[model samples]
Target: MKKVRIFLVLAITSLIAFTSCNQSKPVKTIENLKAGIIGETTASKKYEAFAQKAKEEGHDAIAMLFSAASNAEAVHAANHTKVLESLGEKMDDFTPEFEVKTTAENLQAAIEGESYEVATMYPQFLADAKAEKVQKAEQSFTWALDTEKKHNDFYSNALSALNAESESGLPTGYAVCPVCGNTYDMANVDDKCAFCMTDKSKFINFD
Candidate 1:
């Protein structure tokens, strides 16, 4: 009976140690998640403002595209929030700040923002999450990175069209995946997002 009690105590201590280790917060990963949330949230609001400016300029395609990107950013922010929540932390509420310009200028600005995120910000965040073994945070950063690539491409093309005064550069229909924020051209959209496999039915469609 004494031996049995000793063994049980040893097992309990091991369990407690394991639990404490597992519950330890990943500090860098948590900071990355919070920063990602702020960036995405600000991007969302910036796009919204840009969309309104596009509409005012009678640029339907630009307006629709900005709206789609705005929605995608919101989805990305929500995904980051979910990961943070899983870590038993909540983001402090903050307002987004951005300046709205002409459609051409806005497209250029959008391109720059997406380019930085795809090439620098998201890549670093994903790397940190992977290093910390924060699975959910890694997944969120991966999705944002992939989706930002699409946004970058779209914004680049739009800016080029604006520079050339080509109507062909303006897209009329777009869809953003609710699961991963992958952007799709509704012209020949697949049933599922290639990056995240989110169904078209679950996509947020815009025109």
Candidate 2:
């Protein structure tokens, strides 16, 4: 009987230890979530400043798109903050980057930087959120992806317009399908380039 008691006690103790060890630390509090949202908000603001600079530098369309994207980011940030608040957390104030020079070089750099974040970092973030099963995060990520895709299209179109307006007038005569790389003058342009037909908006003014 004594041996049985000792064995049962040992088993209980082991179970307690195992349970304690396996218990997850509380999920990060919502305050931490707010901080993350603030960070993204800051980034979006930076993009907005970049866009403003681009506009000043004659990239009007790009600037407009960037501004729209910035607003989108702000919406996302607000949503995150709201979620955190719902969880009873206070958010910290965020100050975004503001240094911007209205020069072609600066504009190009800003566009490229934003592109990298959207194309690379954002996608990875989405994947991570999916792995973690954060439904809200996934939704936010999808919104961001869609916005970035639009931004990409805007930038491409703006660049094309800029090039066309440059000293060398739109390359004369040779017809180039904006939808597809397929080059054929007015005579061609059947239905639409297979790739471009998928989404006509993605087509830049190639000719």
Candidate 3:
């Protein structure tokens, strides 16, 4: 009877952590979600400022891209906020910090930020959620991760064309996915967002 009781106790403890004995499990689901919110909020604000600077420099296409990316970052923040609330978690107060520079400098900063999120931050958050079996957190991170890749690419291309001052290959308008924060070319988007499958009709467009 003593041995059987000990085994039952072990089984109960197992339910609280890792499924396997040797593999370590993460336990920071809420922390990761909050970090995502803070990061996205800052990105949104920075992009908004960058958009204004681009417009001042007469780069309409770059300005439009920044505006779309700003909207997308807000969507990602909202998604993370929604998931956090559903889990009965409250975010701490946060203020966005950014510096606006010349269009070329601003584009470089945007590219670097997006690359970090796409390559490091979101991937770590998603891994944490997966290890902890947090489905909502996982979904939020996945959406942000996919969208950040697009933002990184867009910023890179914009920086490359900054020197050429060519709008020929640039998008005329920009659209953002409401659910996943994916940005798309307004002239060539499908009926639905490729990331979240949200209807394109629901997308917010900026020309």
Model 3: per-residue Cα lDDT at residue 158: 86
* TM-score of each prediction: 0.90, 0.54, 0.86
- Per-residue alpha-carbon lDDT of candidate 3 for residues 1-207, written as tens digits (9 for 90 to 100): 999999999988987555555453244888888888999999999999999999999999999999999999999999999988887778999799889999999999999998899889988898888888889889889989998898888888888888787767888898988888888888889898887788988989999
* Residues 1-207 of candidate 2: C-alpha lDDT, one tens digit per residue: 999999999999999999998864214434335544765587578767877676567655555545555555665576666656655556766566556664445446556755875678667766766665666655555555555554455455556666566623222222222322322222333455433342433333322
lDDT of each: 0.89, 0.54, 0.88
RMSD of 3: 4.8
By TM-score, how accurate is candidate 2? 0.54
- Model 1 lDDT per residue over 1-207, tens place: 999999999999999999988886889999989999999999999999999998999878888899999999999999999999999999998988888878998898898899899889989998888888999998889999998998998888887877788866567899888888889888868898887887788888897
> Between candidates 1 and 3, which one is better according to lDDT?
1
User: What is the Cα-based lDDT of residue 156 in candidate 2?
Assistant: 57
Clash counts for all predictions: 0, 0, 0
By TM-score, the better pick of 1 and 2 is: 1
Which model is ahead, 2 or 3, in terms of lDDT? 3
What is the lDDT for 167 in model 2?
21
RMSD of each: 2.5, 10.2, 4.8
After superposition, which runs of candidate 2 have C-alpha atoms over 4 Å from their true positions?
Answer: 1-39, 51-59, 86-90, 166-207
